[model samples]
Target: MVITDVNEYRLELARKMGVTRAVNVAKENLNDVMAELGMTEGFDVGLEMSGAPPAFRTMLDTMNHGGRIAMLGIPPSDMSIDWTKVIFKGLFIKGIYGREMFENLVQDGGADSVWPRSLADHYPSFLYR
Candidate 1:
């Protein structure tokens, strides 16, 4: 899997974690990297965790038709994007507010995992009902 980050340290960490490719966005162009990797069709899947409008826009621009995106980061304010890209590309963007309760997690047996339990216990009023 390819991972992109502005921080060199984080890119290094991703490399250590065995990502197929790790890019430092501060120094290199993402599209150039994609072209070098022979990804002429663009990315098939994208996880948007930065919450930056530019990053999100780049993700939208660099996605292939029928690409799936999971947006987990919460933007600080309102932003705009090219709706034509979404319409013409037929991109599937799912906005994930917070990881409280989700059927997918239960299906994957992650609901019973210690991470969710810890989150629930830490934020009882928000997560635990």
Candidate 2:
């Protein structure tokens, strides 16, 4: 699932990228949607890209046992979270800042040069054209 504020364009993009669901977090009940999707206590991996404290909290709350959360969002300076819940749940909170070596290559060069030739050969035409 891809959570966005209220951008239909982003939702459509997520759908095009094969997301099972694209939820507008601002307009809907995220908790209910998560429950409906059977993501409660079953999701092993969560990528927090919304940068909102509420979104981070929601992701942290729903993580399953031994789950990992990759936080790529940039929260406000005074951001707060439930440390007790995180500690009690034994969740692995990983933070990623900036791109890795491979992603750096993609930034410096085009995907055709950074990715394997075989995979690059199948690059989405729309991305280039």
Candidate 3:
């Protein structure tokens, strides 16, 4: 439920969208926020929408054991991370290419329907509507 962005405007939007915590990683320390929220272990799941390497590294650093991450963004170039973290933490990372959506939409018509409703259900629908 905690979301991080360097952009203040995006963080504001995330707060309005009902995120439990919206952190500007540029100005605030994520560890402090995690401590405040009593997340002594770390996040269980992460969605990497930003292609920034630093953000990806931060996600890796802040995940708990057996954490799951779904990456949608495509990085422009190669980036390195602490492989030990991934190996020892046993984190699961998945690259999400678009093909999976076709299968999902076919298997469950409900998946096809959720996109339009998701804006109203979870996001700031007023902007799009």
Candidate 4:
């Protein structure tokens, strides 16, 4: 399951990545969607890529006890967190920064830079104006 802001492109990407469920967090009731995804109590793993504070909080709130959350979002410096829940739930939080390995792979020709370009070209009408 994947939750993201209302964007068909993002949903398509998640579907291609084998996501069985994709919830548009920007539309309708998020709690209802979470419930539909069986995230009522919480989730086992939550990956936050959206930089919105609310999204981060929602992810935290919807995480199961002893669950892990990996965040790549860049929140504001003065952002607040519910430390009480963190401690009580025994949640594991991991923060990631930089693209060292990805850069290395690009530089070493292990990955192709033109791949994205090709994909974009393949769906020009869908991606471009």
Model 4: lDDT of residue 79: 85
Name the 10 consecutive residues with the lowest summed lDDT in model 1.
113-122
Q: How well does candidate 3 score on lDDT at residue 28?
A: 92
The predicted structure with the larger lDDT, 3 or 4, is 3
Better of 1 and 2 by TM-score: 1
How many steric overlaps does candidate 2 have? 0
Q: lDDT scores for all predictions? A: 0.78, 0.69, 0.82, 0.71
What TM-score against the true fold does each predicted structure earn? 0.74, 0.66, 0.76, 0.67
Work out how many backbone clashes candidate 4 has.
0
lDDT of 4 by residue, 16-82 (tens): 5555577777666667877766755778777787767888888777788999887878888898988
Model 1, 26-114: lDDT tens digits are: 78899899988888798987889899898899999999999988888776677899999999999998888454336655776644542
Residue 47, candidate 2: alpha-carbon lDDT? 72
Q: Provide C-alpha RMSD values for all models, in order.
A: 5.5, 7.6, 5.7, 7.0
Among all candidates shown, the one with the greatest lDDT: 3
Q: How close is candidate 1 to the true structure, as a TM-score?
A: 0.74
lDDT comparing candidate 1 with the true structure:
0.78
Ranking by lDDT: 3, 1, 4, 2
